[model samples]
Target: MASLTCRADCTHPANHRHLRFVWLYFTTVNLSALDLNLLLVFHTVLEEKTVAKAAAKLHVTPPAISNSLSRLRAVIGDPLLVRRGRGLVPTPRAQELAPRVATALRELERAVGDDRTFDPATTRRRFVLACSDNDQIASVPHLAATLASEMPLAQLHIVSIDQLKASDGLAAGIVDAAVVPTAASHADVHAEPLYVDHGVLVLRKGHPIRAPRLSRAQFNSLRYVDTWIVLGRAGVGTKMMDAFLHRHGLVRNVAVIVPGFAAAAMIVATTDLAVGMPMRVAVQLAKHLPLRVAKIPAPAMPIEMQLVWHARTHEDPGAKLFRALVADAFRDKPRR
Candidate 1:
């Protein structure tokens, strides 16, 4: 039993010619009579345009190069290269094959030749991340700043979690990473804790339900703002806020339904609507608005926000750095 592998210095001038030849040879589907030697001979003939030159490069006599070309010419059913006054000119078929070969050779060179350590500061690689609306508010700005300072040449793309359900961007390589709840975690993904947060109810400062503690009945009597998207309604924190309501067979009287925390906060600030949101973001919103915080009537709901990457990219160097930056971004905010 033998194993085959491709490990080559594709940039080495001598090897490049052979790779170019291999690429050219592949275009003709019939390889039943393939011989490695003839492929090299044909490419060398087209490349050097003279047997004497190719032979000189290969450290072989012109007769040997000529014999190898004769075999290739029989299999290809073309003259391949014909003698001019003092050199050779490729036949039309051979000339047509050159461009295709060059394209594949370029791809090959990129894959094997450019194998080196990923340097974040120098790479112009594009990285994609997916997050729901609130998670974006939580991590995007700080991550953007980190990118601007350390990974200046790298590009960042932030997409919504909705795109992931339509197509698995992470496993498919369209998305590099995501900031999501641990419920999305699976065997094929790597999850790293970004932050631990809990939900708090935000309302206008002069609202009627300003009691030191809110009873379930009082909590239900008020109008509420709900977020119905991935992280808004279906998220762990939201479910925790509603847990008490579920247990007591009572639900919040829905007044306004929005897709995100910011929207919920805005609805809560001006109107009688009260929204349950992460305390970290709610605190920030409260600072600039006429908003007041209230403990959620529900028991402790610790939202575990995590950074997730497909196992495919879990060990990628650039991805590792990206993950570190994401972790650093959340680490800056106060934990409730």
Candidate 2:
């Protein structure tokens, strides 16, 4: 079989157009003789851009990946990928076929029940979840414990919610799910309300401003320590707090800004500065610190956290199991 000769710059606009035309020409070629598993190997290698990385991702040996690539090259009648400098780059044909092959594979998996028979105890699938630091602190322990008992072979990869693209990550297969405040708006993204959380003020025990009931004026006069950790696009609870104060023609002084909730708690526990956080989280922190929780002196600012995922994997057994586990872990705990 004659190999297809193409430029290495597969992502070039002109090359992409040419490859689209090539795709039409190759459509009539018999693919029944091709092993479907080799196509999967080709897809992974093209995505990872190196045999070693692809092998690691697929849980296979480097030699296995190389053998699969050889079979794929023979079947596709193209080099498919070529070494460039120290790394490999997909040929124009591979780039053109990549999306189509991935979509076809997803469709085939859906048709075949998408590993509906998945056994968490036996399977070693790794699931990636995106969430903020606070959620990690509050929920990860419970989640890890549950997984250890129920899905010993399964692994969990936690990525910071601030760094995740949410819906886009789900679509690209980078993240299996996300725990975020705002559900992504993409059509393929599905969301479920996980829990409703509310904020309370935290201050050091026996602070000068210590009072059984904080008046709105007292709340506005206090210097505050603000944490900037965000689980979604917007700022953490600050906007809501500011809006409430604005309604009363009042504003609290932000004495300092910290990167995380734990640091904010530490600062509040040792200093006169006050911090507002989720009631459950604040209560949890108070046990170890000389801190006390107080009402926000107004209606509680409700924070609705949600579980989000791509619709494509909604029916996958592992994804379903993970979603259930997350819900159980995050279900509201009685405030201490």
| lDDT top scorer | 2
lDDT of 2 by residue, 43-137 (tens): 77776789888766665457667877886787668998999987799889888787666555444444464244988889798988988778887
Model 2, residue 143: what's the lDDT?
85
C-alpha lDDT of candidate 1 relative to the true structure: 0.71
**Model 1: lowest-lDDT 10 consecutive positions:** 1-10
lDDT of 2 at 187: 58
Q: TM-score per candidate, in order?
A: 0.64, 0.65
Alpha carbon deviation, residue 98, candidate 1 (Å): 16
Clash pairs, model 2 backbone: none
The count of backbone overlaps in candidate 1 is: 0
lDDT of 2 at 138: 81
Question: What overall lDDT goes with each candidate model?
Answer: 0.71, 0.74
* TM-score of candidate 1 versus the correct structure, residues matched by position: 0.64
